[model samples]
Target chain A: MVTLIQRILRGNPTLFFVYVILFVFFVFAASTAPQFRTVYNISNLLRQAVAFGIVGIGQTIVILSGGIDLSVGSLISLAACLTSGIMIGNPTLVFPIVFLVLGIGVLVGLTNGTLVAYLRVPPFIATLAMSAILQGSVLLYTKKPVGGVTRGFMFFANGQLGAIPFAFVFWVILLSFFLFLLRRTGLGLHVYAIGGNQEIARLSGIRVSVAKVAVYVISGFMAALTGLFLASRLGIGDPLMGQGFELESITAVLIGGTSLAGGKGGIEGTIAGVLIIALINNILNLLGVSGFWQWIIKGIVVIVVVAAYKVKE
Target chain B: MLVALFVVAGIVSPIFYRPQNIFNVLQQASALGVVSVGQTLVILSGGIDLSIASIMATSCVFAAALMAGKNSMVIPITLFCLAIGALAGFLNGIITTRRNAPPFIVTLGTALIFQGIRFVYTKGAPFGSIPSWLRFLGRGGIGFVPASVIIFLFLALVMEAILQRSAYGRKIYAVGDNKVAALYSGINVPNIILSVYALSGIFAAFGGLVLAGYLGFGDNWAGKGYELDAIAAVVVGGTSLAGGEGGMGGTVVGVLLITILSNIVLLAGLPYQFQQIVKGLVVAAAVIFYSFVKVSGERR
Candidate 1:
């Protein structure tokens, strides 16, 4: 058993351990809470994980390219603010507003990428500035929550087909698409290469700048998507919507085994990471723990998970 | 450029020349100025401390909780708050250095932890006014000079002298410039990094003290979002984000510049929202401007 465990550890250091811990937590939660065994709760858990999971996908791409996007949460707020502010329960405005939000996402992503790839600004600093700008703009636009979400918008988030929520379906679709892109595409290969060694990747004839730029653009789009879903669910656009989401996504990515320095890890790990977080949150809510305590627990979990990986290394 | 800004402020709003306004700017700048000093040191050592705001917030809450509106509790409560801040920094440094973790993530995590503690302690609502002494430190002036400004200037000068003339200061720069090279030269790189983070925590705590005093009370919401302001000031001061290329003098100028710009915006009667946009733009522009200058210099 020891030898088998050692072999599995050698084969993939990050994935297996995090998975085991996740499985353990799942079992523990399932046993402790009777509601945890219900189909309703399971679907709810998956639904809760969707947004962070989606954002985590984008974060995985960026981290794989040796960059981080702190602006994602703010992008989410921007998307929520813009979409709900414009749509205002008008079904006719939905399509145009969606396009506008995506366009803004692309624009912000392009600017972020250009700063990092072309101007040599550190990814953290560039995205930090971008986040500040996005957040400040959103706050400037609306000092309070703007309500006017359409029934259709709410349905998009809260609706389900048969036994499954649309959110879960959306998360699955995003998961499959990104997993394929990361595992099967040339762009994914180059991303890993650049993250592993930027100079080597450049010397090896990869268009490092293009890959970096593309990843950030994808990240922005995903964040916008998350924002849209968030607005739909809340039935309002809040300037503070998606506050601290960047950290949450990063925590999920890190828990999933993605390295901050980049090159290693993928979406599968992030999916599991998101599930772990969702489960913990679910359990806390079930136990009636306060949000403040939840924060402490989440913070400690991040440190512990990171430290665990460090120990293995 | 800073002088130009001051002159522009005078031209734009006659209130800018008012003694009260000047004192307000000075007092306002001092809180940020103290935090920026420690941020400069942390960045100088090739590290970033995202927890400064959290530390400040936590210290403010801690001090307030302990004092519970009592004057005699001031000194002891202040020391306790500072100690907690230092302890938090020490933990951050240890985790980052020993585990080879990214300073950003580690500090980010620690920030959450500190924030969590504060929230749990305050239960989302903090009460208790500050002591009269602290209130004076926060708001009172001796003659035309604000007490906060005096404290800020005194700390800034001391830090500047240390960074210039102290051996420890040079070691910090050396470590930041190139850790491997510094390690080889036996400059104790880890300790320097650790101490810088500790100092950042202490300074942020001090800043929180001033802020608490300024408000004359403590609240859970105090010191929220000051991290970006401090970082913006440091960067605008011409300090490289990559570290090892800035000083306290530059940070002071950056702090003043930010304060004055906000003052101008307010004096010009712009909405508060514009200030956020401007701050975001200023940080981005400052970094871009510096990077372009560096690129041109390299080519030459």
Candidate 2:
């Protein structure tokens, strides 16, 4: 056990550091807040973490490919609003809406990819513009919560298997798939290469543009999925549902040991990062802290963690 | 592009060309124009300040809260607000440079922090009103041109000269052009970045004050979307997001272009949604155009 721990410490200090923090915080929360230790609250926490977890996974991929996606949050808002707006609590409409939202996601991702890869627009500005466009479109559609999901759709968010939320299970499945892709695929290697050095990646014959586009596409799909799940859980689509999520997902990715500059880090630590944020939020909620404080805390945490990573370097 | 935009605006609505309306547009552009100047400086240093909007909101509210409609409190409160802005920028700079964190992430984090501070300070309901003197600075005209416009134009010219003629300005371009080269050349890269951010913050605070004066009241969302607008203007003005190229001249034109576009939209009574969509399109289109220009230029 000692040797195993030492290997992990030496190989992936960021992963180890994050896990240790998560473990300690978990223990503290469980010990101090009886509510936190309760089965219902634990399940609730997992459900809450699902949004960040799913989106952070996508964000991780994009960052690893040397780009960022500010459009994810707006995409989520559009997806959620569209899902419920079209479904209108009708079971028959659910599947169609799902495909439609996913298609829009893909299209938006493609636009972002083309702009960044082909036009050479900076990722920050490209995604930021996409975000604005989506936000405006959503606002034009509806400024308030509109439409509701069918009862069957709620299973995606609220269904459980032996006390574990179905959303958590779905997230784990997606996580496993991405982990496999990143650790054992050519595309994954190309992504890392592109992020490490775009010029070198191209010279080395990697389809850098294709890989960049693919990561963004994946990010878009994941964001759309999150929107669907959120709409199901809330039972209604809210135009403002996805606000601040872009920053939240980025914060989670950064905390998970992913470098914002790209080419280093993986999805493995993102889960812990998601949990850390969810756990912090849960503890604060249980302690009767206002939500405003969470923003301040999250901001400080991001800087401190990134700075610590810098120190390590 | 400016002339073409103006012609388009005139065709869209004759009201756009009225002297009174034109001054109104200039006044509206003043705050954003000032903020974009700061944003221009930061971007020139190869750094972005996402926190400027948050800083503006914080300073706006802080200024109003302190001034509380008292003339005697104006100078002190104004100084304090500028200090707050500088402090926020310093934090952003320190984290970005010293900690080796990306400016994008650092500014984003500080944006959240400053926003949270604003919320905490006001408990979500900001109060207080701008004094008459400041209000005049925002709204009152010195004959044909608005005072705010004059301030904006004067600052732009001064900054233009500084960028064109000063050692500090040359250092900014040097640092942005190539950090390692700048370091080897004995330029203090980190200090340059730090001071640039501080200057950006000070400008943002001044812009916030102008905005507060115009509105005559404190608002938590005072500069909510100004960061994007500032960026859009800066980029549209021909400043490269990659850093080291572009100037205040292009920025001024960009600011005027954006302001006029919005003014035309307002004159035509278009919905707010259209304005946002157009803003997004403008940013994307400008960047794409610039990239093509750069690529073709390189080919030559």
Candidate 3:
């Protein structure tokens, strides 16, 4: 057991922190709240996890490329704003409408990629500008929340298959596919190479720019899916719904053990990280910690985790 | 040419430079300008402080609670906010300098954490009433020169003197432009990074104070999107996002340009949402065009 533990810690910079947090939260939850142990709460946690878990995948991809994309949350908000108010509720449009929402996501991602990849504009500036554009565009589309998405849309957000929420299933399947792609393919290798060292990757014949654009495209697609689920579940999509999800997604990715400087992250780590964050939120709420301190504690956790990694390095 | 555009804007709408509206713009812009000033320093040091919005919001809540709570404890909270801001900035430095964490990611992570901290303060709603005196700082002017603008002017001069004449400032530029060369020349890169974040924090806290003063009432929502505005203003003002180019003057112009653009939007009676769209377009255009110009200049 000691050797195995040492192996895990040696392999992952964030393993120790994640272990401590997960173990503590589990113990606390089990001891203090008997209700937390039930299958119902476990499913509920999975359900909550799926929402951010999906978005966290995209954020990890982008961050793994040595860049941060602030525009994902805005993209989610815009996708929600576009789909929820009219199409799902109108009953007039076909699946073509969902295509339109997804199409919009691609366009947004493409714009970000083109500017950053082609124009030599910094990723931070390009995404930040795009976020502002999406935020405004969403406001223009709907001043407030719109209540409607096709009844069929609910299948993605709240439906259950053999007791598992469809959302959780979708989240898992999506993540598994990406995990495979990350480890088994040339695309994954290129992404890691670029993130680890862009200049060397360029020297090594990797199309560093293309990988970056691809990352944002993946980010945009996931954000769109996240928005779709929220719309399906809430039965209403507010233009402002995605205001903080960007940070949340990024935090989950970081907590999952991905290096911020890029090139050294994986989807598998993010899964654990997402679970850690989701569990932390649940435990904190259960502990009756005020919302204010919830933030303080969350910040402290991220700092400690990252700081620990730094010290270890 | 940009100066002439400003001239034309003033002519297109007399309100563009009206004393009252100008005061309003200056007061409203002070907080962002303060944060941008800090960002300018960091960017020059080849770093970016993405947490300015969070730092500003944290300070905003701290100041609001003080003024509204009217507790003699206001000073400590203010200092506390300032100290916290510096620590946050210093933390960014430590990650970047010691752990060799990239400033971009360090600040980005801290920014996310800071957002949560701000959310906790209000949980949704901000605290405290704008004291009359503080409110005056936000809305009133002294002898026709607004207090916020005066503070902005004072800050600009101080920043200018430091950036141009101070050895510390010279070291920052050297570190930013090329760290390896600077290190060979005996510059302490990590210490410079540390001081940059500290100064950035100080400036950001000052901006938060101006924000609290001008805008009465505090909530977790304060400075929701100011970081983008700041980066936009900083970049538009001709400060290179690449670092080692431009200074406080460029940021001032950037702030002024955004101010004019917003004033024109309001003058047109367009919805505020449109203002955001316009800001987005303007930032993209400015950055893209500025780079285009720089490239052409290089070719020349």
Candidate 4:
């Protein structure tokens, strides 16, 4: 039991930092605002975390396989636009629209995968270029925001089950799926093998390129889901809706103890990381810091957290 | 050559390659070229400074806030903004090199923080006025060229010299090429990385000022999406994003390529959507060719 405890402590210590930050934020939130304990407020926070958490799942897969996806945000915007068109037109279309959105997401992911795997394009540049294309496409397709009677979509999106938001359920479902994929399957082991040593994985016949493609596709799917979620929540789809989400999703993944170098993260850490970020955003709101100052603080913390994690490693 | 494509367009339309149009291309490229200089430095060291856009945005906001007048605060505040940018980069370096974070993650985190700071300062909406004294810097020019463009060129040349001709430049290449080998040679690799990022920060901040001045106003999003553009420019210019190779000269070409394409596409009356498709194809093609060249060269 002692050895197991030590193993847990030694194997992953980012949780400690997360705990500390969580504690600090909790106290800060309580002290700064008397209404920090409202059920509505707490649910709001979880719902918000759902966005980053779900997207981070896809991000985690890509990062675990030694890649990054900057195009996730733009994918989100596109997905939201596509799905909203169908769902807002009639509630009956929601189910079909979800698949359509996912399909679009998969296509985007495959494009990224093809470039990274077959052509050997650098992940950063490839995804970055993809993002630009996606953003520009979003702007060109829908010149302005698409607003209508999206109450059905928004109702389902914002609905809560026993204080757990509907989006939170979606996040949980994704987490369960990825967790299974990462633990029970040969694919999981192969991802680790590739991330740790690409040449050896290829030698082992792990189909490294296919794996790379799969992860990016998963990322695209998640990004699309998030975009759709944002649309449902916003009751409209804005062309520039997911403008800076690439940075945020990437940040969450990093903060979750996933190494940007790839092959070094997990779902649990990502969940924690998402909450940590959500908490930070909530506290900033509570503190009423200038949005600019809040940005500065978040940047400093991310830099510091990443640096600290590396130092320990 | 893409130049042939440009020439064909010029032939098809008489004013396509006119001096005025080409100058417009140069003007557009100038701002990105300035920021790309810094990006070039960080990449050369095998580090990615993703927070560059945030730093640029921060500088834009601060510079606009300080555009109260050409009082004693002008020069000092300008210096302060530059220093802050360099300092932000320094912070990025410490985490990346000293603290052991991947440069990508460290910068990514800082990018968020800086973005938040911009939002907070502006309170979801930032409105400001540029002082009359600095209007010339932002709008006026010496003869025909924009003062901003001139500054962009000057910075690019200076940075190119520093990267290619200077001892520090050599060190940066050495570290990027092989940190273990560099450290064995007793090079302070971490310090060098820090310095390069710091320098990158300064360039980003400088670019922010140019962006603000040229636009004659500043906002939290002034440099929005610029980091990606600068990165694309550097890569298209034939600078290996892998580091330890390429320089400002190539980046200049890349920036010009993008700027010119942006202009020419508009001139061709291609809608923005098709223009994006074209841009993506061009970048995709560039990446494929670049990969082919690098991969083949490595084999040989």
Measured against the true structure, the TM-scores of the candidates, in listed sequence, are 0.97, 0.98, 0.90, 0.90
| Residue range with the least summed lDDT across 10 consecutive positions in model 2 chain B | B99-108
**DockQ of all candidates, in order?**
0.59, 0.62, 0.45, 0.55
Off by over 4 Å in 4: A1-34, A148-152, A162-164, A286-290, A311-313, B8-13, B69-74, B118-146, B270-281
Off by over 4 Å in 2: A311-313
Candidate 1 per-residue C-alpha lDDT over A1-313 given as tens digits, one digit per residue, 9 for 90 to 100: 9998899899887789889989999999999999889988898788779878888899889998989999999899989988889888899988888888888988888999998999888888889888988887898788788856899878878899888898888888888998889889999889999988899999999999999999999999889888888888888888888888998898899898888778889998999999988898889998889999988887787777666566322
Model 4: per-residue Cα lDDT over B52-110, one tens digit each: 88898888788778765444555776798899899889888877877777776677777
Of the true interface contacts, each candidate retains a share of 0.53, 0.60, 0.44, 0.76
CA-based DockQ, model 1: 0.59
Candidate 3 local lDDT, B201-234, one digit each (tens) = 7777768777877777775656766777777788
Candidate 1 lDDT at A285 equals: 91
* DockQ result, candidate 4: 0.55
Isolated chain B TM-score per model: 0.97, 0.98, 0.91, 0.90
Alpha-carbon interface RMSD for all candidates, in angstroms: 2.4, 2.2, 3.7, 3.2
Model 3 chain B worst lDDT window (10 residues): B69-78
Candidate 4 per-residue lDDT, tens place, A184-252, comes to 898888777777779999998899999989888989988988888888877778777886677777777
Clashing pairs in 2: none
Chain B only: TM-score of model 1: 0.97
- For model 1, what is the C-alpha lDDT against the true structure? 0.88
Task: Report the poorest 10 consecutive residues by lDDT, candidate 2 chain A.
Answer: A304-313
User: Model 1, B213: alpha-carbon shift in Å?
Assistant: 1.2
What tens digits encode model 3's per-residue C-alpha lDDT throughout A159-184?
88998888888888898899987888
